[model samples]
Target: MNLRNKIAAGTLVLASATLMPFLGTWEGNGQNTVYADKLARGLPTVCKGITRHTSPYPVVVGDYWSNERCEEVERLVVQKGQLQLADCLTNQQIGQNTFDALSSHGHNFGYVSTCASRAVGLINAGRIAEGCKALAWAPDGKTPVWSYVTDEQGRKHFVPGLHARRRAEARLCSQ
Candidate 1:
């Protein structure tokens, strides 16, 4: 089935497929490398941003994943993330672009956190445009929420890449 049909059917398989390139573009398909997540206080991450918490296999700092293993894990991780996000928005009637944007944002920040965000609250309140705007800003309406990455000292610094990603997500959501 096509992505639109699958989305209309309330299934996320095709949606996941459609969102894979978006995720890979942002996350980078580091299939064989396990690196420390500077944003997450040095959490070991591998294979398209799969951490120990997200991956089915162990995610040690020095570990290397085979291409097939990485592909399988990436698919599993994205599917799980989509499921979590879908469950959170079970009652909301949103479009494919909005769902894809939210899925991407949720994948990076976390589905639970995204669901509880001011953006989601606005969406639930039927203010979708405002919700899309809210995705790029904090409750104070000035700070870029997802643009900061934590350093080893636990200090947060703004990252242009993350800010750009948020902007892209907001644009997608607004569409």
Candidate 2:
């Protein structure tokens, strides 16, 4: 882990005893797949053909599979993820967008993982805007908060996909 992750993890360990209230699960007719796809990084496959599948776990992109197998993976991953978020947070009466955003983050990292810890703290503190913004920073924790970096040549490096997930989460949180 990086320095930021280490710090967040240490903080969560100290705060784990506290129980956060439950928020609703990811809502939508088909939203789960959308948020999950961002995390899945895999293509869906079935009947010896590849389509696109969004799963919480890693999968071989072009592997063939039965429809049942694909659904099972999605179900299990979502179930475990919900349980993890339920365990990690308290007093979470957040809206669909915010909740889904956080759930995505929790599912990707661990619910109690340091990165989550930071976002959790901000959310709980009622700094909704800050918290939402923090979600985008949760990945490596070193992603430039200002959205840019300086190279040795004194050249400015604009971070692109590095915080794309976080940006998506932040957008959801704002809604």
Candidate 3:
């Protein structure tokens, strides 16, 4: 082989070695992942909930490790979910409650590992009994515990709304 051919061959070899771990031949044990997103171009279809996809193009000698290939994909997924949940929480659906944000924005899953939002979801789903029961097992316990400090008149106001009301009151008093 000429010098240029030898260099090209060496590069091909290096690329192949780098991509070996994610070549789609290695199977996952529900532990360390051997493949990135999908297993192969056409994974055999089976099971009730399994999904599959086909690769758009042939695997070259040196494809970069995709984000879907990392060992910490689960962690990354959780982090992404947390960010998403925060965005959802900040929206007007819950009145932008400060209690939710203070309580890790309902991502605590409590000490017993249950999402408080699930109970809330159930109530919204018209299964109040089930939702309350679910929250009873949550970290803070009590199916629908509201975060609060009593006002002068003792109305149970949502924390964020209370802050807004206080601000408005101050503005009015200043006027």
TM-score for each of the candidates: 0.84, 0.51, 0.21
CA lDDT, every model vs. true structure: 0.78, 0.48, 0.30
Best model per TM-score: 1
> Each model's number of backbone clashes?
0, 8, 1
Worst 10 residues of 1 by lDDT: 1-10
Clashes of 3: 1
Tens digits of per-residue lDDT, candidate 3, 82-136, equal 3343332221222112212212222222211222365445534655444444433
CA lDDT, candidate 1, residue 134: 84
| Candidate 1, 1-175: lDDT as tens digits | 1134445576544335557788888888665788887667888988778898888799998887898998888888877777677666643467767788888888888889998888877876778888888888877778887788867677889998899889889988888
- The reply for model 2, stretches above 4 Å from the true place, is 1-63, 114-116, 138-159
